[model samples]
Target: MRRALVLTDESARHPFRASLPPHVVRRANEVERMVPWRLKLGLTRKEAESVLATYAAGFVCTLAYFS
Candidate 1:
């Protein structure tokens, strides 16, 4: 059940191979690989949102630092 949901969500996000640039798609795949699969599957909606927000904030901070 969980696996099916995960697959469905992932497919929904990337409905086509060319939906994103090659580099962006590669980077996203890399980041997804780094995540603990179990943790990702187990996270509650709010917890998942918090984790995503944290990642977004860190990405913004890193961009700011380089710029």
Candidate 2:
């Protein structure tokens, strides 16, 4: 299970794609059960994907379901 932090226009940026914070990575990893509805994390699909890629390094996250 992947915990996608939904990105928004303001939160979207290229720098986030450079590196991923270990703490955040751990936090995302801890996410086991997914909620029924999407919870807003102040991010968008493109932005979330970029960050996940940066943190996981070659890791790909699907955006259909996110928190």
Candidate 3:
């Protein structure tokens, strides 16, 4: 994802490189790199997956509508 973002940034000026530093809220899963994050704050795997899934579905619907 990082690589893709870098490649996609058309401007020679790197915005993310200068400001908006990357912050890792929770380490992503090694096996499933697409997994968003795992909070140490104690959300179970099932609960987290459900939450992310809901957010993803909403986002997809929004994009589909706009597109």
Candidate 4:
């Protein structure tokens, strides 16, 4: 996703970028990459819910770091 962002300069110039520092965006991207995509496809409903919670927690933690 980092590579994609670099390739697409339009997105890089988004107004939100002014508020969210580059470091914060990079940290969030790293957290996103940590999610188990293949494993998620095979998970049961309950298991998927847990995984979603974990993903959300990671994103929250990343944002919390900026605070």
Task: Give TM-scores for every candidate, taking all chains together and pairing residue i with residue i.
Answer: 0.40, 0.26, 0.41, 0.37
The regions of model 1 sitting more than 4 angstroms off are: 1-40
- Report the C-alpha lDDT of model 4 over 1-67, residue by residue, as the tens digit: 3533333234456766545656777776664546677575777779888988999999999999999
Give each model's whole-structure lDDT.
Answer: 0.67, 0.55, 0.57, 0.69
Output the number of the TM-score-best candidate: 3
Return the TM-score for candidate 4, rounded to 2 decimals: 0.37
**Candidate 2 vs. truth: CA RMSD?**
23.6
Point out where model 4 deviates above 4 Å. Answer: 1-40
- By lDDT: ranked, best first: 4, 1, 3, 2
Of models 3 and 4, which has the larger TM-score?
3
lDDT of 4 at 31: 45
* lDDT at position 13, candidate 4: 67
Supply the TM-score for candidate 2. Answer: 0.26
Give me the displacement of residue 39 in model 3, in angstroms.
Answer: 5.2
Number of the predicted model whose lDDT against the real structure is largest: 4
Clashes of each: 0, 6, 0, 0
Task: Estimate, for each residue in 9-57, the C-alpha lDDT of model 3 and write its tens digit.
Answer: 2332555533332342122213544554465456889988899899999
The true-versus-predicted C-alpha distance at residue 19 of model 3, in Å, is 32
